[model samples]
Target: MTPLHQQICQACMPDSSPVMDDQRASLMSQLPGWQCLLQDNIWQLKKSYRFSNYSQAMAFANQVAELAEQMRHHPALLIEWGRVDVYWWTHCIANLHYNDFIMAAKTDQLNVNSG
Candidate 1:
């Protein structure tokens, strides 16, 4: 990431409690792979990829887990067959946060690169 963009991201905070409608829209656009759930203000993503059968899916899940751990953030993970769903929100912020969306996008990038 560029230094300027990194600076901006570092300065960001989670969306304020009771997420505003417009902010939600803006954040959703910032996230390409994730879909914004209006009512909950959470980002949700589901993707299916070829994974050398079930073992590959498991490996990918582990990778995601490691990423989340290192980020000190977590996303709800649902693994089924060859699909994975990631749901991200900030509990402390009580809504979706900038970091959450950023990390979600990073996750997508990781998946694409791995593929």
Candidate 2:
């Protein structure tokens, strides 16, 4: 199977079902440091990355934005002085999907390559 980071996100429909239970667990294993959480009654994949300073954090956020545009799957990003918090979910589905996992893995890849 292809690594999650290497997989491209497919277009999701509003009626699509969120990845659940065993599938969610399996995918989550491929991404370390990411937490599965319920926010606003919806499941999301979240992680926080630390940087040396605000500039570094903003750079990382920009990288993430580029990745999101390429994959056509965006995340919620909270950029601060030295950290960035990312939350990935399919808003159309109003929950977590495989695309979220893919984006999370790609986000990790960006951090690895940048550091």
Candidate 3:
């Protein structure tokens, strides 16, 4: 099977079901440093990356934005002076989907490629 980072996100609709427990567990295992959290009754894949300065953090955020655009999926990005927090979830379903994991993995790759 292709790695999550190499997979492309599919168009998710409102009716789409969220990732099941077994699948979530399997996918979660593939991503390190990511947390699965529930907020507002929705599951989100989140991670924080540290940088040396604001410029580095902002640059990473921009790279994530470009990735989101390319994938047609966006994440909530919180950029601090030396850190960036990324939250990935499917807005239409208000839950975590396969795309979320894919984005999360790809996001990790962005950090690796950048730093």
Candidate 4:
């Protein structure tokens, strides 16, 4: 199977089901330092990347924004001094989807490529 980072996201329908427990566990294994959690009653994939300065963190966030645009999947981002937090979830479904995992893996690659 293709790695999640190299996989393209698919458009999700409103009725589409969220990621299954078994699949979620498998996907989460592929991502290190990432958390799959429930926040505000929504399941999301989240991670935080650390940088030496605010500029680096902002740059990383920008890179993620560009990637989101390319994939047509957006994430909630919080940029702060020396750190950037990314949250990936399907807004329409308000749950975790395979696309969120794909974006999370790709987001991890962004950090790797940046540093």
C-alpha lDDT values of all predictions: 0.62, 0.94, 0.97, 0.95
Cα deviation of 79 in candidate 1 (Å)? 0.9
Off by over 4 Å in 4: none
The residue ranges of model 1 lying beyond 4 angstroms of the native Cα positions read 1-19, 38-52
Cα RMSDs, all models: 4.1, 0.6, 0.5, 0.6
RMSD of 4: 0.6
Tens-place lDDT digits, model 2, residues 9-88: 98899988889889999998899999999899999999999999999999999999999999899999999999999999
* Pairs that collide, model 3: none
Q: How many backbone overlaps does candidate 4 show?
A: 0
lDDT of 1 by residue, 42-70 (tens): 44433344466677777777777887777
Can you write out model 3's per-residue Cα lDDT over 24-51, one digit (the tens) per residue? 9999999999999998899999999999
- Cα deviation at 5, candidate 4, in Å, is 0.7
Residue 25 miss distance in model 3 (angstroms): 0.8
Q: Summarize candidate 4's per-residue lDDT along 2-40 as a digit string, tens digits.
A: 999999999898898999899999999999999999999
TM-scores of the models, in the given order?
0.70, 0.98, 0.99, 0.98
| Candidate 1 local Cα displacement, residue 7, angstroms | 7.9
- Which numbered prediction scores highest in TM-score against the true structure? 3
